[model samples]
Target chain A: MNAILSDYFLPCLWASLASAGFGLIFNIHGRGLTICAFGAGLGWLVYLLALDAWGQDIFAAFLAAIVCGFYSEIMARLRRCPVTGYLLVALLPLVPGAGVYYAMQYCVQGENERFLTTLLHTFGMAAALSVGAMLVTSVLRALLPKFHRAIH
Target chain B: MNDDKLLALGAELGRRLMSSGAEIYRVEESVIRLLRAYGAEPQVFAVPSCLFISLSAPDEPAVMRMCRIPAHGTDIELLEQCNCLCRELCRNPIPVEEAFEQVTHLEDRCRKHNPAVVLFGYWMTTAFFALFFGGTLPDCLSAGLCGLAVGLCALFGTRITGSNIFFRTTVHAALVSAFAFLLLRAGVAQNLEAVTIGSLMVLVPGVALTNAMREIMAGDIFSGLNRTAEVILVATAIALGTALPLILGQYI
Candidate 1:
């Protein structure tokens, strides 16, 4: 119970609150706000679990982003809103903020090797996130017409 | 209404969606869809900074409208409302005059969240991010305080006329990092990196980068490139801004 609390539950809760807060800043209100928060929390949870299992940050981010993308598309369909309304905020926790800061810091200090390494890592993580999300969304979009026809 | 008025109305809707930070393709699609549903075939092109639309019908001459969209903050509520309006228009077509009224009303009252709620959001976002990044309790508290400063800067930054994007972002980031460094020096915060990064989340261009990738994937290469450039510029500004203060603090 304690392990679950410390490792999984608490972090997911914080991630949800943080994403929801950002949703508010972007003027997402009411039920949309709650749904965004829940999706963000789920994304973070998936990210943490993936990291623990795979021990690769980029892979974890990629997997988590896939989940987020799928969730956003499904929710957008159900809620009758745009996918971006959910995807943007839910993907915030994995944005590589620290990497950007450290890369810049290294660049300023004239540590070219470290700066290059950090910059590449940050960009790679971002690419992974985008690619993962794009994979799901593109596939879904391609299949959407058939899916709609079937439903009708 | 005449074709000219309808064209203008369509362009205005496109303008609102673009200014609210909707994707270029989404704006173009919405505008084209809305116009087609109302019995006009329209050609629409949209980018981050401008929109071009031309409308024509069986018996009417082509009517064109061009609008230059100013940069604005992202407001998901407005985007959702606009999307809903589009869906409604498609299903149950409204009169052109009534559609104009709806679009104008949305334009006027698009921003829904109040100042206080927005400030609280900033605070909570920073605080919880600190926690998410493995900060201790004190770290979260200090980050929250820093977030208050960031919130204030964002609130007042928009009011300052002639303040360009690069200058505003650089200043805001520099100040936030400098304040974080001071708290560290004063022994008030244990983890400087966590606190600074948490507070800095507010300035990161996550939305721009994500949208850029999506646009590219969706094959809107022009808009994807435009948004990618924007993300790079904003990221560089933030990195430069945060680095300056850290370098200065190191010297001290």
Candidate 2:
């Protein structure tokens, strides 16, 4: 894990910085910085883990979103701030900008299967991440609205 | 002077007003208005409250809390008497000012590094170098540098360009293809992969990946998935562009 973290040094550094920038806009306070940064770091980890799990350079991206949401709530409550700061930062890693582009290139070249599979996977991963965040938040709200409300 | 304090003040306000019965949208608008009143151009979106982020100046401030604040009065009162509410609500105007100043300072920094120059310059240069000298460097260094260039450009591109997915991907891919083609003509003493590595740098959507994860965590599957596709597309485009020239090289 350390090795993988150390490997993509620049991406990690920039992503962290970007997360910090995000923190400022959303008015993330106290632990919000930590929460935001964790999301960013872990988001990158999604790609690394996906590569290890699937043996391809993919981002299993759902985890990145889910983790970001879970942490955003946890951190927001802890810090008594909003979740926007952390969520945006955490989201830095799973944008699928590269995936969508490649899929198009493949399609343009008439490589249908590669395009379809890659495109589907990217979209699926994104869908999973988004749904996960909503589920966690709704569950959190249902399970402990009082605790969650205290943060804001 | 610091960004944290302003954010803290805003957060405190958010926390304090949660019990006052304001919808999240009202609070968001109020906050954005406050930021704007102070001359900071904070972007305030009314989408998922979970994603309420601002790109006002140099730094993007994030929303940390999720509590709802009650509007002080009805629409008739608020719309008719904003000045009264403004004075009544703001306890610590200093924090708002400080935050505005900090963001303005940041906005200045962003303006200094024009996206057109940075994106275009890096795109052309990375490709030119990869084509001319790709064989001379180590594989890791080549890929790393290329990645650095593209990653950096994404930051500016996100800000300068319109917020459209298709536009962003198309520009990124087209640039990568242009650079890859240039490298092909240079005929450097490198294999296809090495050259590909160089051009591939401009296409990594590192930010998108992180954002997707964040959305998922925020529990917005539709948004999270949409974003993931965008980031992945960028990477694929870079790879394909560099590879295309190689395959065609055999014929040429």
lDDT winner among the candidates? 1
DockQ of each: 0.71, 0.11
Give the lowest summed-lDDT range of ten residues in model 1 chain A: A143-152
Highest TM-score model number: 1
iRMS per model, in Å, is 1.9, 11.8
For model 1 the local lDDT of residue A144 reads 87
lDDT of 2 at B211: 49
Q: What lDDT is obtained when candidate 1 is compared to the true structure?
A: 0.86
Which sections of candidate 2 miss by over 4 Å? A1-38, A43-64, A79-81, A95-98, B1-169, B180-252
lDDT of 2 by residue, A68-129 (tens): 67876776566444444455446644555445556765786789999999889766665565
In candidate 1, stretches whose alpha carbon ends up further than 4 angstroms from where it belongs are A146-152, B57-60, B108-111, B161-163
TM-score of each: 0.95, 0.47
B3: Cα error in model 2, Å: 30
Determine the TM-score of chain B of model 2.
Answer: 0.42
